[model samples]
Target: MTWHVFIKELKDSIRDRKTIFLSVLLPILFNVGLLFFLENVMMNEKVEQVTVAVDSNTDPVVISWLQELKELEVELVEDPVKVVKDGDALVAFIADADFITKLEKNEIPSISVFADPTSTKGGTTQDLISNVLTIKKQEYIAQRLADNNIDPLTIEPFQINIESISEGDDMSLYMISIFAQLIIVLAVLMGGLPAANDLFAGEKERKTMEALLMTPVNRFHIIVGKWMTISALSMLSGIFSCITFIIGVNLFTERLADALQLDKNIGFFTVSLLVGIIFFALLISSIQMIISLLANNLKEAQNYISPITTLAMVPYFVLIGVSVTELNSTHFMIPFLNIYALIKQLIYGIYDVTSILLVVGSSVVFIIITFVIAYAMFMKSKWVLGKS
Candidate 1:
């Protein structure tokens, strides 16, 4: 409440190496490490090469179709079964020599694909073969329709284009949701324990808390001052980490643009992201402050905060496991859930005013509750004077 105390606390925080490290250095390291690791794992990994063996008596059409998948190496072998058994090929295709003749005569032709199901390449090879076979089957069906003087497209009456119409028209909304959720979790993890430590155990250990209580300052002012100090540090860490993430996203966006289906041209997304960051910072800071007030010492505070941080992360993981459209009002009211939902909406360019209001309102409510609890804790003689 007092500018002097606030300024003094800020100076102390800046001078505290532990606080500075947690608030700044740690977040930078975490963001860089995470981005580098993900980039290496996702972008640098080589595409697996598959080998397919076709029987000598296989139909020319099928053989040609196999060849079309040039990315996959195809070889003609005298015995398809032997090729598969000898491990010389990952997959073998055996087709009836008269398969094309039968198809021409309006008869169905069958082909057998063989591989060791337990083999390392089995799943990959099977998927490749299935994709090729599916295309061939579609082609055969289309040809049959054409032969009967019918249009295959007409038979499949309507084609539905499921376009996601978020406000910003960016498909990266889903990925942005995930990143937002992670940011919240990271904020809690980095700040929660240290904030708790400073407010409870640090005060107790310093022996300065009791002397402050004897001063003319209200217990509420003391609590608010301490709370503000820890929350400021926590918010600083959150903001730094978020800024790092945004920068990393911009740098990584080009590479992941196709995979994430992002519309990189949408600049308005930055505005929404900034708004979300403000709300998220306030929300987590308030929550951590309340948790810190509840603990009698640093160790106890950590024990209390750890589970809450984990609980906050649960909704994010749950959302990840489900579809975006499945998000509803219940999720909007949930703490971390609401943050992620709003972020997803923003990323997709769907900035719903009502959703933003709900998130802001909920955060305010939590902040009020946190302050109320902290006020009550501060009023206690033992907590204020640090006697017990």
Candidate 2:
């Protein structure tokens, strides 16, 4: 009898094009569009090239040095500082009049680099010019030593090396963590909403509720079957969301794929992730279904669910700026945030048995609680009979 109700509900949902679109096509389009926009933003944020203006009377070494640096354009100007001030150049170098003579005479000569410190582009260009000046100074010192019949290598200096003891240098986990919360939340809301509306308000509006109630099957079976159907449909959306993310990360962004640190044979891990998604979907669907059951009609349910959808995303946005190390066991008790933390841990390759057990145990407890609440709403005789 339960299977019959479940099959009937599943068939009805399949016939509804809105359910299919929300569960499948919507996630694909949204994920692709967001990734494309982000890729463009990352690409466009780069400093393409810097233009450095030098005074015509500047030493030849500095001019040659600036020209040799990659992605730099060197221009000889009558007044380098004026060129920079007039916005014709990012930065300008004004050399001392005694430039080469001072170097040859072993005297420290000062040159002025003109730039606006407040501007990002100007500041970046100035830094590049400053590095070039440092390198040129080192070259001048070497040349002076060679001219005096001394080995330039005799100047002693200690070498420093940097080696990281942690995992590889992929930082896209931060982006993936935020995106996981967003897509999973959206999948639950969008996928379950249509079905939730139909389960109560649609039946009430279409005048089909009395016939279903007249059937000999127990109310518990009817409610349980419908709840399973709603959870299944929501899980479909989660599947679509996961597919979209995997494809986008692996194909569109190598950095993100590396950050995820996935195993080549990810079958077991994938199954576990899908299981987590399904349980989360079950909880969200029950709440939405309960809300829909209380509303008088589909329009009322829509009005109610809109605010809930926004409320659902609040935790994700709050945690978007937060780091992994900052999160602790307390975060595991929050609704949406718990799932976020779980998925983040999975992505970063942290799979403590106790952690998974805690998340699954908490989820099962919430699922049972929500199911009881939704069933109570479903069994309301007055609401079911249109008396209220």
Candidate 3:
């Protein structure tokens, strides 16, 4: 391909407002906007007040336990059951007057926690009460163990230490995976349309494609030049998107680190992230070019390429559905699936060279197929000349 022709195409692309918007401005705005909204949501705790009704016979220990959580507003009242049933309280605790007597007799005292599970605050209040009750029960167990001259640790016999084997095991990585998936979907949706429109229908509409085909340059060279330009533009958008995302992540680093339960060095994932972005961009761009080349007009091209964009997004939902599923070579060879899986692994700091190789290999193969098809379309007299 002539450098002059490539430069001309690049300049033309730079002048296209739609190209600039898709390739740079839109990705940046989307990343920043999404992060800002999520940060605000994460920082704000929505709990207003928790109302808990207590029966007349409720134990002092239970009442005190409920009252101790200053963040929660607990109200003690007669007829706790009635209050809960009437929707006057978010939760109700009913303790029998004989609870202490039953405990002394070594009988499990049954206490019913009543709450409307469907109510807004009911679930939260119920969970809070359950946690408090569990602690009280554990305390009672420890006391019982002490009374019997037994150590609680000996009775438990074994201590289990749960350790996460995944690298970057934090909330940030999880959130990043979600953001990455969204970026892929957005890149395809926004970039696919214009790339298809410009290469296929736009050329037809402009009537310049016919004259260009009359030149002595080989069809393969012409297609390669155009493909490189479109791919570069798409890749530019993808890179910008990743940069914006990293910036947003850095902005909320303190809060996100806490929320994600991450160490200070989560930013190290940036390298692998950019690698994934470039790979994904190339794959989607090639697919868009092929789809666009198949269309007869802008409207027809959009109709054809729209489904491809949706197809590109299918793996995102599929990956979410099967996130816990084991990874294998079969899974690694699939196009979008490999990217999503590798991204998850990358975020978690699990680097499997074999999987990466497979993904890269599959991508290269697909890229080759796309170029071959694109060249065939470029060589077709009617299609290249816009006579059909």
Instruction: Please report the candidate that would top lDDT against the real structure.
Output: 2
TM-score of 3: 0.74
Least accurate stretch of 10 residues (summed lDDT) in model 1? 165-174
Whole-structure CA lDDT of model 1: 0.69
Provide the lDDT at 239 for model 3: 72
Candidate 1 vs candidate 2: the TM-score winner is 1
Clashes of each: 3, 0, 1
lDDT of 3: 0.71
lDDT of 2 by residue, 1-388 (tens): 8889989998999799988899889988888776665555542346477788889988886577778877688889898888888988888888876777888889999888888888888888778778878978888888888889988768846667897544764345666666766776687668878988888888887778889999999999998888888888888898888878778877786666676766563564576667678878988988887787878788988999888888877877777776666677767666666777777666666665565666677888888888888787778876664544
Q: Write the per-residue lDDT of candidate 3 for residues 196-248, one digit (tens) a residue.
A: 57876678767767777788977677766776677677777777876776666
Cα TM-score of candidate 2: 0.71
lDDT of each candidate versus the true structure: 0.69, 0.78, 0.71
Per-residue CA lDDT of candidate 1, range 249-363, in tens?
6675554344334355345555555566566666676667666656666776778877887787787777786566666777677777787777666644465667777888887
Residue 369 alpha-carbon offset, candidate 3, angstroms? 1.6
